[model samples]
Target: MKAFQLVSPGKTELRDVDVPEPGPGQVLLKVTGSGVCHSDLHLLHAQQLPFPMTLGHEPAGQIVALGPQVNGWATGQHAICYIVWGCGVCRRCATGAENACERFPRGLVPGPGLGYPGAMAEYMLAPARSLVPLGDLDPVDSAPLADAGLTPYHAIDRSRELLTPTSTAVVIGVGGLGHLAVQILRAITESTVIAVDLDQEKLTAARGHGADHAVLSGPEAVPEILELTHGRGADVVLDFVGVTPTLSVGAGVVSSYGHLTVLGLGGGSVDFSASGPPQGLPWGATVSRPYGGTRRDLHEVLSLAQRGLIKVQVERHPLAAADDVLARLERGEVRGRAVLVP
Candidate 1:
């Protein structure tokens, strides 16, 4: 079998490895599609990593074999992999919020492509509990729902109370997650969806995904969002790019008492102050940094996709092109999500 492995810090290679068999409670999948995520690029250049780890987390495939003790899942069924492997005993997991499992390290996220062997290969091994049926959706295109779609769904679900018809929502960064965020908002909420992005192409894509307004992100973005909201600012701001500029715009345009969810790994921060508005977030505003979605979230995301309310705009590539695809993603040239077909 061929696998794309991170050999050392800031490097990756396509290497030959033996096919892994499913262990107890696990199922082996014949890889059909694996979505390439920005997180993979982050892991490539990470300061530290578990070398020789396979490098893909979002995978969709058909079940080929099930290990002992695994039941209810059958061979040849198409499924999407839920990447968050949480300790099921934790309080968070018990409540279906396993993305924030109590036993997970404070700063480190351990999952497929992070600490465990991933799906950027001919086959993948996943716990039966982590498998979500893909139904009739194309496995190659539906892979990104594992993360790009599910993450924003979780963030929006948490802030659903703020997205009433009279309210407004802003999405910053019209990349993979942001594009899906727009569609999710449109499908699930009546709040006016405003999208912001530096690239005109992405902004156009956002509008196509049902964003009511698209604003080119810059010094003018805050005012444009404010204008769109009639000077009240957005009731919810979802920042998919966590860089200083986008963070600044989100802080500038979120209404007082609104919710601001930052899902990007851009390594940026904002200052907090008692005197709000210009110096900090508005009074009563709340900010959250959410992780991946729980099992239920993944199921809901797939339901949306199955209903044709949302779809991932995917660009498929061969498994051997993993390096090139990561390069393109790093340079911000890949639109929508890139999937590796094995």
Candidate 2:
């Protein structure tokens, strides 16, 4: 089987590798579609990584075989692999909060494409419990839902109470996950959704996806968001671009008692001071940096997709074009999610 492997820092190659067989409680999948993420770009440029590993995390495929002890799933079932492979015995996992599994980094770790072999290949192996049934959704287009959709859903679900009928929700950086955040908010919440982005096209797309207002990200972003909310500020601010500018705007515009969730891997930080109002979070405001979605989140997003409530805007490419797609993503040239069909 041919797989795209990241052999070293700042490099990747398509190499022939032996097909892997599923182990106990695992299933081998015929790779159908794997979504390339921005995190993959970070991994490629990072000095440290689980070297020589196949590089993809958002996977949707058909089951080709199931290993011993695997039950309740069939050989031809279509499924999307949940990215967080957690120890089921842990307290967090017991509540289906595997995204924050207590055992993680202490002998447990992130699933495929981050530390383990991923689905950017002809075939891939996944844990039985990590598989979520797709139920009539196209595996190719459904691939991004595993992350691009699920991540934002998890973030919004956590801050759901803040998004009341009269409340306001602001989404920053309407790119892959940000765009989905807008759609998910529109589908499930009555909050007025406002999208902010530096790109005019993405802002336009966000409005098309049900955003009530589109604000170009700049010095005016904060004032516009505040003005739109009638000077009370947004009750929920989701910053998918966690850079300095976006962080500043989020900090400036989020209302008191509001929830600010940062989902991007952009290494930007804001100063905090317990003493005052202009330095950090305002009185009663709360902030969180959320990881990927739980198993249930994946299921709910899939349900939404099945009902025709939300859909991923995708650009399809062959598995061989992984590097080229990565280049486009890095240059901010690709819009929406980019999926590699194997």
lDDT of 2 by residue, 156-221 (tens): 999988889999999999999998999999999999999999999999999999999999999999
Instruction: Kindly report which residue pairs in candidate 1 clash with one another.
Output: none
lDDT of 2 at 200: 99
Candidate 2 accuracy as TM-score: 0.98
Error of 2 at 299 (Å): 0.7
Minimal lDDT window, size 10, model 1: 105-114
Worst 10 residues of 2 by lDDT: 102-111
Best-performing candidate as measured by lDDT:
2
TM-score of each: 0.98, 0.98
For model 1, how big is the CA root-mean-square deviation?
1.1
